[model samples]
Target: MNEYELKVFDEIEDWKRKITRRSGMMNRVSKKAQEKINEFIPEKVHELMTESIKGMVKATLFGSQLTTNRKQAIGLSLEERDELVRIKISSFQKTAIIEGAGTGAGGILLGLADFPLLLTIKMKFLFEAAAIYGFDTKEYEERLFLLHVFQLAFSSDEIRRNTLAVIENWEQRKKELVEMDWRKFQQEYRDYIDFVKMLQLVPGIGAFVGAYANNNLLKTLGETAMNAYRLRILQKAQ
Candidate 1:
């Protein structure tokens, strides 16, 4: 499983930790927002809200491993925040494009449920930053392909329940293992791969359509592809 799959269950908890973990930065962002409060909202509570906005934005931009997240977050101004959000939306739109180009059944299965959730969260920030951005029906076709794939692959009720159970287990364990031991994590990772292979067979579909049934699978492919690209670029620099 990739980090996102590992993170799926405890997404909110991890986010809470990330926000508090950088308290000084949070304070600074809050401080700035407080300064702008009189002009923006005139309410004292709204002024205090600057920190929450700042912390949330900071986390959204830096928290996710997606390159688009990091890229759009930099050098932002209040004026530019809206545009940044647009870029973030477009970035995911491009992901929809790639998913359509061919991630096969496995890719499609993963995309349906997963993409919408991911897009929903990403857009929540993007939309709030600027009111104009919202979910597009035009993008539905490709995203639907993903949903179809997931539904087909994990068609059985029992398998879905078991998969979810493991996900919950991973989430519960992760908080306790925040400063995880690499060697142990590595072993667990190997086991994860083994488990995925076993589950993949259960779907009994073609490569193109198979694993797409589960939302988790597409995330793995997307992350792995991006990581490989980054690794190659770094290798060339060396």
Candidate 2:
């Protein structure tokens, strides 16, 4: 395999390590939660969490494979790598929001939609928001920044460490990229341009924000909000 191909493999390996470690952490958290629940509640709650995590692992694996394949197909250079990541991250983030808003059977568009369409929406929403809020520079900038961050897949320390390790492996393989120089990859150019064109045909926004928001927000706000959200959803079903 060429340097590019090697880089992709290395990245995959790192992803595996990160996923394993994170999964372990999640497992521990789930175990502790189950213990607490079992203390008060009569029956075992193991199956629900166990099943959810199983599904999460499956989803994680699928995402990793898709990303690896795309990276290999495009033979992305350092520049293209950044661009691809930006596009994917932003689109992923927007999809998360839609998911949180409750899309039901449709799933989030970014996760399930055609890639071209998903890419298109991210760009369109960004520009349209810019035009509408041009004079209000602060808000526009904030919105734009949030959009970019949403695209950033792993921002939290735990997730970031794993992501960085994966990127570092790629950096080692793609020596020409100057070791983690994602900035030079010009991800914004491809991500934004593609998003704009796609918007005319299909529209969307940030999934990462909601993920991060849910994690961070709930962390600070405590479990009450989560329980409330859960109870509400359950109530709706009943």
Best by TM-score: 2
Candidate 1 global CA lDDT score: 0.34
lDDT of 1 by residue, 111-185 (tens): 333333433344233322222222121332312222222222222233323322333343243344333222222
In the range 1-238, model 2's lDDT, one tens digit per residue, is 4565455445545544543444356544644554454467433444453444334433443343333322131443433443444454455455544543332223345433433333233333333222222212133333323233222332333433543443334324334332232321123222322322233222233343333442332232222111222222233333
What's the lDDT for all of these models? 0.34, 0.34
C-alpha positional error of residue 23 in candidate 1 after TM-score superposition, expressed in Å: 31
TM-score of 1: 0.23
